[model samples]
Target chain A: MRTGTGAGMPQRGAVGAEERIRAAAVRLWSERGFHGVGIRELAEEAGLSSATLYHYMGTKEDLLADVMSRGLRRLVLAAERVTQQRAGAGPRMNALVQLHVLTHALRPRETRVVDGELRALSGDRRGGVMSLRDEYERYWRATIDEGRASGAFRVEAPGMARLALLEMCTGVARWYDPGGPMALSEVALGHAQLASRVLGAEELELVDEVDWCRGLVGEIWSGPGGG
Target chain B: MRTGTGAGMPQRGAVGAEERIRAAAVRLWSERGFHGVGIRELAEEAGLSSATLYHYMGTKEDLLADVMSRGLRRLVLAAERVTQQRAGAGPRMNALVQLHVLTHALRPRETRVVDGELRALSGDRRGGVMSLRDEYERYWRATIDEGRASGAFRVEAPGMARLALLEMCTGVARWYDPGGPMALSEVALGHAQLASRVLGAEELELVDEVDWCRGLVGEIWSGPGGG
Candidate 1:
């Protein structure tokens, strides 16, 4: 996952210098938070000079905004793709869960960056990212509402229900360890069950139950595989 | 509520300097996070000098710890009082909701500071505060578990049920307004209904509803009448 080159660079086994810089920035920001980190330290950590760091990404605030915007854009795109692929409210909701879980599994740093640093983005930048977030929230809101209206979901207050579901999902990033216990697929399915139950899913077939159990068992047995 | 004056103070109507400092710290911390605000600015905001600020509160970190510890201690005390005042899981849970809602409504800045700045504390200070918080969470967790065990609540997982309930109560701090259309009592009642329902409470009597609503209404309607 860390082997890819930067946007303009040719493909190689090692990430291009620009990509390396961005990756380093993500790591530092996640650990120290947005305001606590400095550009000089980030540059040194990335094994680059301050001038070279600017060549890759602009100011510290610009890097923060870019990190958040890029991550949110990917999430929105994934959600959009899921919405496109799945047909009904139930499947679409499931797809949404899968996309969220997969994205968190693959890019936990990016997810944390977006979640923790939105306040650091000021004015139009903050508003713009927040609008994107609202759109993503709408996906869940619409699914919950549509499911309720269609008699598929039994929960009251679609808005509150959406909040509950999203919080549960977003919380995954806080505790999820890709190398620990359950595979991403398994974790997603378990979360899907939790979400579906909250949304009033009536029953789980043996196969679904088996799949969920297998995932849990795999997670417990593996004892934290490679992230 | 702001009329407290320490002994030897000349002004009778003025709030004590210590209380004033805590209030200012809460406001500043909530607006700008723990690491973002400076003691000098906090002093100025509180209409005092840095020297005076030191007289009341030792250091910036000390102020942060004091603010968080005081708020958390109040919540713990409130929950303890509520538990002692009410019998049975149902009543106790109602009391818990009232305490939580009231604490959040009356002291939103403090609540925000505690919730948002826990990660910034270290060693004994952080551990002490966290232990208190955990104990507070346990009160709700125990109520939910008891309710479920006695067939009073119908949630599958007591921990998740507790989290859901706490999230709803804590969310009041995010959107609550004194001049909103619904009185605090009305909003608290609505939240109580939502919390009780999530906890599998069946009855919806007006008294229980009002008991649930007391904190929010008390916070708003009793603004001039009380704190």
Candidate 2:
């Protein structure tokens, strides 16, 4: 998963140049579309020369694909971990919603890039990113399917319900502000409850799940895995 | 509120040049953010010279603002017409969802610009567009409030519920395809039912309202009002 390291750059290998490059790419690409940015601009933003940029990454499209892949793959990992222990559909859905809302709230720029830039990639790159996204979405689909099977939830169109719920949670990225009046915990809990309503499931007390998901977001995003 | 009309362009004034310019702006701006596009490219896309582009519209920001205002204003008009005769909260909410889903599905490019470009404008222009958007959102807010007061809807937080529902409905623009398996009517009704679930209200048979709203979308978007 890591690339563009020289023998002399070992000290910075853990968390310096490549991280800066990823950060710069996410910021610029999110501000402007993929075609709207240039390699030199990315290099300057990352405080590297153009030659060094190419040394670290492939083409600009490659960089975009890398950013999207990393983000979606991180989501896949987090969703897997969150739902691994939860057996009941209601609690599973609640935990998933809280995790998603918190992720979108904390990592809005990355979420915007992943959501908005899928059409910008070429065929193979697009397919790869799309597959990762689909993989992530399956967690939601399976939760709904399990809920329907056990008669824990009642939805006319499970597919449409999943889509609606995903968009609703992902939208926290577009507008959530840390400095806003609503506490992050409140937002996560509110969305979890909303998810229950959307699924026509009984409301469970998800305060603990919300707090647990917050810790999980901190771990995944702060570690070398995602951020 | 058109700015680019001149004295000598009566024949093209009604529906030819201005419509082309609006269409081109929506397409380009939706593809690229406001800062990502250039005046030269916009003029080329509109099939007009740069000078003529200036004559037809103000600055680039002005054009963006105009496009947003037109799209949002059309929603305001349509929402008012749809909700005016309906007294119950369920019926009103159902109609609003259908209209919004249809508008976003049919005019995705315009919806993208309106939803995505609010940050690109300066103070006065941003304030104007924001006012139109807030005005449009008030319809949803009032409907939700009415539902809560009348005991027709049950929700923990009306504001959060409103935000979630709005995002869910607006998401139709991101992925809907007319040529896809789900007909437009199914998409609209599906969303209407989902909205009902979110509000904890009984599902209303909104098939008739969905059909009527489709006709309303045709009239508003196809006429000089929105398109």
Candidate 3:
């Protein structure tokens, strides 16, 4: 267990007011939507005055863009780490699934806001968020392409496979209940197998990768940067 | 080629003003969400006065509920028709996939509202929409269970597999483009194959089932109930 000393990482035990505001925004925006939630409500949810909320966050859209960018940046970082660590296409894709499943399942609110509220942004903000998202998706794209090229995946349309698998995994956030029957680990493993099936790859045991990605999720989503 | 003579089916060649209002609601709500859009904007979009919009829809929530129920009802009807027409679990699931993909592709806005705006409803209205949705999901559940029981599908968690496949298919509404390279039929066929793969079933030919489902989508989504 390494300490998070990154620039935006929160101190060991202190959760800043800005982090609280971000948490409130993610919760509200995900339950309703970006346009559906108001700053006053957001402030109340975060236990801050409107003026205080405004002091920490510029506008609602700015806060939304900030939230989206931060969430996507974490995903891109984790996906990049997974790619760098796992050389084989099979292992890389499996780790990506586990990481994505864990992220969506554990941080359902933040991931939902990131997935569902992209349309609320405009112009340059939209483009910036989209760029981060594109960066994240490129990892899956490249891994699938690599697998297909190596004859490890047998999908006819690599691009479609990527989109379907991504959506399949992302949907976990919509319906996953922490108190549900299956443990989060089983859900992650099931998705990995499904992704492998979609890509026509041989189903390899992904328990170790899932455990590793679980640690990665904790690392990236922890501290001050944690949502 | 048969006419939609069933009750609630719109007459041929005539788009009623109420239908226009429904279309406007679906379009606006899908873009901005149910709580984000106001009645004035909805009226403006539908080329109706505020009073006229009210005449067509009781309340904003009523309109949202209406949109959701209509969209989901169409799905339930199509799924039922598919089940009646296809007895084998493999063909039944494949046709369900194509019907779902086609519906989502052809009616993205209406489906988006239904998928995203359930929380915007209240009391019995929410319950009603959820029941319709649950009814539709039961078809997928039954088909998957049957497949697994008969050894036609291999999955540890059939429920999770059902959810994964549904999300994967429902996601077509989020990304399918008519002007894109693949024809709608190809998208449908591709998703059917993907579902088959996820179930670990032999990849049977789905061209006929896909074609049949294309017509089924047309029949269910046509007439007065069309979104």
Which candidate's TM-score is highest?
Answer: 2
RMSD of each: 6.5, 3.4, 5.0
lDDT (10s digit) by residue, model 2, range B41-82: 999998888888888787998889898999889899899997
User: B42-125 in candidate 3: lDDT tens per residue?
Assistant: 899988788977876878888888878988988888898889988988888888898899888987887898888887888999
Better of 1 and 3 by lDDT: 3
**Candidate 1 docking: what grade?**
incorrect
In model 3, the Cα lDDT at residue A178 comes to 94
Candidate 2 regions off by >4 Å? Answer: A1-15, A203-207, A225-227, B1-16, B203-207, B225-227
Winning candidate number (lDDT) = 3
Which pairs, if any, clash in model 3?
A10-A224, B9-B224, B10-B223, B10-B224
Sorted on lDDT, best first, the list reads 3, 2, 1
**Model 3 TM-score?**
0.87
| Model 3 chain A lowest lDDT segment of ten | A6-15
Error of 1 at B36 (Å): 1.9
From the highest TM-score down, the ranking of the candidates is: 2, 3, 1
lDDT-best of 2 and 3:
3
